[model samples]
Target: MARKYQRANRMNWLMPVLFALPLLCLAGAALLLWGDQLRDLINIAVKLAVIS
Candidate 1:
């Protein structure tokens, strides 16, 4: 009974990490593909802020 409880507790934390790994990979891939575009957007926003 105690072992089952321990296993369940371990899985509770592990589950979220397992779920997040794929999402993190996808985000990394997106950044790699569009990093230049993101940088341009940020620069544009900064310039607009300075102008205002």
Candidate 2:
């Protein structure tokens, strides 16, 4: 019973992280296209903040 509860908790935590992974990849791709500059950093930060 305790193990099941722990697994449920872990799954709950994992789902959001898994979903966020794709968005992170997309953000990284956008950053690559933009080049590594202050603008790109700000854009990535904003994108991550909004998605989260």
* Candidate RMSDs in order: 3.5, 11.1
Model 2 C-alpha lDDT per residue in residues 1-52, reported as the tens digit of each score: 9999998987887888898999999988987877668687898889988965
Worst 10 residues of 2 by lDDT: 31-40
Full-model lDDT, candidate 1: 0.93
lDDT of each: 0.93, 0.85
Return the TM-score for each candidate structure.
0.57, 0.42
Query: Which candidate leads the pack in lDDT?
Result: 1
Residue pairs clashing, model 2: none
Clashes of 1: 0
Which residue pairs show backbone clashes in model 1?
none
Best by TM-score: 1
